[model samples]
Target: MLNFKQPQLRDVIEAPADIAQVRTNLARLYQQKRQLLTDKAHWAHNDAALFEAGASYTRLFMDKMWEAFNEDKLIGDSALIEHLWLQVVQQEHGTAVNVNYADEAGENHVLFAIDQALHVQAHLTAHELPVLADITDEAPDYLINEKMFPALLQIIKLLYAADLRFRSPKETILQPVNDLHFGVKFPDAKTFTATLKVSNNVAVPVKINVEIGHYDVRSFQVVDETGNDVTTIGKPHVSASGTFSWEAQHLPELTNQTLTLTVEAVAIDTLPCLDNLFVIASGNNILMRTGEQVGSFQLELPNKQELGITVNSQDETLTLHYPDADTQIYELAKTYSFFGEWLEATLKTAIIV
Candidate 1:
């Protein structure tokens, strides 16, 4: 009998429809992603916004992949993953990605390596996106569907945590040693650079921490042994006081190299001395200015608001004063002189040696 049984109705009908549905879903997804990307094109000048837009596009793309792909197969095709990642990098101008996870409000957040983010922005501004491929991650290029995506998410989480630290404004302070001495370079009233050298005489290696006080300052840097920078450790914290601990190995011996940092002071609280007379403060240091003649004073602040100063201006003489918390009046200087016993003594102690 050469005759064959007829095909089952379920198999003949369901399979073609399922394949068509998958193709339809993918096509719709591709179109929606293209539209989202078109909207993102306008956000080139803004980082956070551009990142958000790119994140939305990534979520759409990933959702389509999940819907169209078989869970038992490799997650994303290598060529397709690279193509999409590169597309996002070129269109959004960075390596930021959305891993399709929701936050407390059920919002998808964008993830990025901040160093890469900064580099991408620089390259985009310079019109040179081609060179960025060398630095970007191809991890997604290796991920397998369902089986490897979880691991990939975990890896991205680590990168996210690191990026948070990298972008934070908190200074890292490692093992504190009393043997450290700072050479401060004062450029102006509120600007200074400090070089810290630790004594190598210690029998054991000591760790040191870096502290960043004012976040509104111009900039900061931490240089390493080979003249390379390790300032990523000095990101500013939201609070006025934050610290980061460093391993002993991270710190170079004092004889080999010293730690250097630059800080620009922003005036926070000011105390009026007299008419046109005021004391401006940057961190714990105060600058008392009397008509172009300025004297620097160090006021150790347990809290910024606890300290107060008053100036009593008199004819042919000006007096610099500070009132302690107990309301006792202390004269900082009685007279203005280019070189006076009181002024010289105060400067010698007030200025960082």
Candidate 2:
């Protein structure tokens, strides 16, 4: 019951012309196979030609093993047989079943493709004799089993490791090629609104893969006037737009306290310059400072690390010094002067570019 339209076995034939030298080889193969079938003691099936002299060299194996499928046959289709065959010889994966025949120790009747390949390969290697007679076979996974498989695997692993390539366990599946840009509009004191701009350069769906909180700065330090250090004050929350936030209330005594922030960014073999960051606040008086010196600070748009912030003082302008940098004072001219007499700043922000 096979469909010719869908692909069915019209022929099964494989033979090696050189193997014709052994008169008993093919004859014995057939003779023993027939006797085994007749014996029925170990016979798996009747009328199945385990050794077919008339079939082609490789087809002889299929002729014996084909068509006895239980529900859900492991073999995809008869079409797969093409991989096992050339004009006269079968290829690597489809050459033979790996099952070991009873002639060997701990062997079974099931002729798995790999087992058969190994058997044939070993037989050919040991003696100056050819079982198939017509073809020579040697390649990867040809016959991997008990005896030589471990050694073969060891050799392959050594070669693979030597290739100088590393496989990461935690990295995302694929890198995001599309640009990740966002715009932020702080509408009120309690909320921050942002817009995510993404592109469809990748075929797969895009999700936020890079999160700033996951990256840790080993040397991050925050010291309050009470001498309390809270470096791990909740990593800055990251949105699709790359905006990050650090909750000061979560840092124990950091809310109404004076503090200094120092940070360093390090990669495997390289280190970035350690930049000291500080934030001093009392009541409503806020003083934010950064860098080694003030004057050296460049007014680079979009690249400004410490943007303008609100602070108390008649000057209205927040003074941020770069202590680690050359002596420099960056006067943020756009100071939001408050109406109250004493210094008072509720929420501070930079001018939207």
Candidate 3:
């Protein structure tokens, strides 16, 4: 999800009572709009009396609601209110409405500019009362005009949108991370490195937690590109279950750079032996022995690299050759029953670096 700061405005409706009233009015207007849209078929069939009655009711209701909004001063400053109203109207109605005013110096000043995300850039200027007068005079006609129902709906939606911006609870957003693969030798510990880039748009700093599965994390550290210890930026803690969590403050927003996470973890080695089938690993090689001879076994690496197994039918020994090493001979004592048991044990015991 994209993260960006929400637009800010002054004297926004903040009081609980004012917000409650605004919400009530918004709901009423929404219901009215829904009814109007629902009766579109009847209106289109030239039900003149029905259309006139609906239009009159909507106009009177909206005019009374607008008067109430002004009397309650839900949003202080007439110019600011008009600016927000026109901005939303323009956006939702797909038509730009003139919300700007010319100053004494003959310079046109925008009351507010709304972008695609409804982000507002507001500028206080003169001639606000005239703009408000224009809106008030033309609003009743707009409400009665059947073609302008969407604009009326936008007015209601804008009120709720602004209310949410000011009164809604803050939320912390987190992006999902891809799956991680850790490679470690059996009965041995290996350190693996993963990189994460943090992008935050909220005002407060956030704590990040990375979870690792199927391994026990021994140590974890965070470093910058220059190998400087930036872990002091936050208190880093590693749970016994292999979760590394840390909070960083005042980190620079990056478009491309990323922080490095170095973790030292050991693979779990409690794989149970079944039916004389046993998996043994020494150095960088894992050897599986079976009582019956098998032609071959296919092994897949965490990196999607496939490893070919070399079978020694004489001893019923299957050897997995790592790409980084040559095939080595191992002396086997007991043979296993099937390759499936060995494969399961190898998967459980294997860790990618």
**Backbone clash count for every predicted candidate, in the order shown:** 19, 31, 7
Give lDDT tens digits, candidate 3, residues 316-344.
Answer: 22345445321111101012113233443
Overall local distance difference test of candidate 1: 0.32
- Give the whole-model CA lDDT for all candidates, comma-separated: 0.32, 0.26, 0.37
2 versus 3: better lDDT goes to: 3
TM-score (C-alpha, index-matched) for candidate 3: 0.22
Off by over 4 Å in 2: 1-154, 157-219, 236-244, 248-255, 266-353
The digit string of per-residue lDDT tens for model 1 on 296-341 reads 2233333342222222111112222333211111111111211122
10 residues in a row with least lDDT, candidate 2: 169-178
Which is the better candidate, 1 or 2, if ranked by TM-score?
A: 1
Which regions of candidate 1 fall more than 4 Å away from where they truly are? 1-192, 201-219, 224-256, 264-353
Give the runs in model 3 whose Cα sits over 4 Å from its true position: 1-20, 42-102, 105-108, 113-353
TM-score of each: 0.20, 0.17, 0.22
Q: What lDDT tens digits, residue by residue, belong to model 2 across residues 1-353? A: 12223221222222222222222243334454456566765454432343232133334333332322111133323222212221212343223333233323443332222212212231111111111111112322222232432222222122223221112101110111111111122211122222222233333322212222312222344555565765465454334343333334332323334455443321211101111112112222443332232212222222243332222111222322322221111111112111111111211122211
* Rank by TM-score (best first): 3, 1, 2
